[model samples]
Target: MNEDAQAALGILAQQIRMAGNNPDQPNRVGNANPALSSLRNPVYGTTSLTLAGTNTTSQLSMRGCDGTFTNINSTNTTTTGIDALTCVAGGTNTVPDSIAVSYEADRFNTIPTGGTSSLPTDCLGNKLPVVTATVSTIVAGTASSADVTYTVADNRYYIGTASVANVVTPSLYCKGNGGASVQMPMVENIETLQLRYGTVSTASTATTATVAGYLHATEVLTETSMALLANDAERWAKVATVRICVLVRSENPVAPNAASAQYTDCAGNLVDNPPDLRLRRAYTTTVVLRNRRL
Candidate 1:
């Protein structure tokens, strides 16, 4: 349980870091990428951790690129084009996680002359294939630039949990090309998972903003509704930090003679009466979203 909880924390932090790509800035007049999704709100989190009871749901969703993509469109694979996004419409037609990326052989020879192209594989490294749609131009009048394009497979990931009574296990969900959300078991025996979003406020004179305080998902949504920002993304843009807390218990109940342990939970409440004798532990960490800042 300890190892699983640690790993889960790391994985959750990574996802939070990649949650937003700053797709929606102050300037939305004409700046929109066709390869990315129309949903600009990067992070959506919810948690119900009170002394009363626990909520077995973590709709904490994040949207961002995962790895370099290979455009499934053969026509978009121009010999001269490089790092082009082929998912022209990201609203309805979502991209999926696909096969390895293939590129032009000996394309290095092409770059020296002018017509250059590539399809490098994202082996261990993942990078968002962000680029413009137009073709590259080497010379003023030369037609050497070819249209480069690639696929944007799966980009959005979220946290979910199994709803079995008394045996809640937090899981991860992701969709490919607008497919059904697949539940991925991240950590077992995670009875309670709580999250808090740190809201930030930037003064007119300050260059960067600091976290004002932490609020639950519902409160954040309410603030977003009151904000005088963009109609769609005002809620998610205000969150600058995320606090993740998960409770992991042993696989089996402990010995009867073993003293029942009392502990404090993720919500800072002391759990006086434990349900069982099984060893239980709480894992927590505060993740800061650098993408939310300048």
Candidate 2:
């Protein structure tokens, strides 16, 4: 392939990677993409450790959602210990084993009660609106009532500091200086993009959550719909995954052929007789929210 063609393919790859692998910030509650809004909450799961065998003197460790482990020493009985058996420190004693350790999603960081006087901004200086009922808690596990400070935004897997934004409303087509209509490329060669959301219903009992169905971005992108989604904790809690699809084309045109090629779009619609000679391809990816799963 020529350098230009290689460069075009590289751009397409980069865009797909960005949309697929970019993990949501722990604090970011939902998808902020202007063109496509979907669930972006991190999945909530549990990490447990059991204290068994003849090892009373061994210190027990607790791993947080952020992957950091904290040593639970015998002295930390009142705070981190579970029952009468204290997590011992620096000794080797046998029997009287405490063989049970449970992790429940009891801690949450929410927007301060009664709203904040000042606006909140992320680390990237992007302004954040006052989010009501923006609670980040663990689901599926037994909950603890105690409010503990936990890590929310682990910058490790995050892509851009600011939320993804696009100017979809404004048309890029405008009149040129020569009084001729021309298309100005705001984002080069990206033709279409679509997003689908998968939501689960709140479990009535301790059973596993089930995904209701996939909905297009337009179905849930309205103001009223967004409000309903935000206020309904059960609905928000049910968001399990998001599917992203991006369609891109080469800047240069290919050899024109009499027969047209058919392509399958993101919505599973067949596009017959696609008349463009520019080499085009669609990329798709699915992201699961670990914190939302059981």
Candidate 3:
């Protein structure tokens, strides 16, 4: 090759080495994926996914372990670190589940609606918390009225039946706050929902007013217990992201023919059928809590 071309190649090689092999920007150090070392540059862009259909494009991006990003859509998502004990069976070896709940048309009726409604029971069902220490399946059928409540706090988990309950389950989880009501257990509130990052593995309510660190309202993981993981970062090294999703239902499910269907208020009125529930376009990301020397 000519000297000019050779020089250009040499310069590019140096840049790659200095910036790391990845086309993406610098990662949050500890969270950088060595496997993705060559693929860098994560930004908002639309690619012609289709051959000749329409010059359409979709938004794509990546996030650091200790970072957060928002998508083209207005959904707000968070990615942070949680305790290791909250992971599923695979623990750090796998991608933790993700749950995204968006405001959809009320399930109680057709067309747009108003007011909050209860979620569908057995939707994803209630999964158990991380009891095995190696991550376990979120126990389904874990939400019982006698064992849970939402009247006081956002993330509260009680035990037994609402009518004749007493002792609370140590592993129960609950921290929910929609616009109107908080759906506990397995209530499918709206028309449709989406799952991103992973799945809707578990959802538990808190018993009293407790500050959930890495836990999301829809699912539970070890990272949710931030202080616990912070104290034992070595044990909780598998977690990469802690995301939060909110499934807000309108106060009342309105009929499709409602005159105020087109209204757009805090209660979120709509004129047509809402789209399926997708992961919030935004999220807060955190790194795997590990002791770093000062």
RMSD per candidate (Å) reads: 14.9, 22.8, 26.3
Q: Each prediction's Cα lDDT score?
A: 0.43, 0.31, 0.22
Question: Could you tell me the lDDT of residue 92 within candidate 2?
Answer: 20
Q: How are the candidates ranked when ordered by TM-score, highest leading?
A: 1, 2, 3
Instruction: Give the alpha carbon lDDT tens digit for every residue of 179-222 in model 1.
Output: 22232445566665566778776332226667788865445545
- TM-score against truth, every candidate: 0.53, 0.35, 0.18
User: Which ranges of candidate 3 are over 4 A from the true structure?
Assistant: 1-236, 255-294
User: lDDT of candidate 3?
Assistant: 0.22
Error of 3 at 229 (Å): 15
Candidate 3 C-alpha lDDT tens digits along 124-204: 222211101111112353421111111101111111112215622111112222222333332212211111222111231
Q: Lowest summed lDDT over 10 consecutive residues: which window, candidate 3? A: 128-137
Best candidate (score: lDDT) = 1
Name the TM-score of candidate 2. Answer: 0.35
The TM-score obtained by model 3 is 0.18
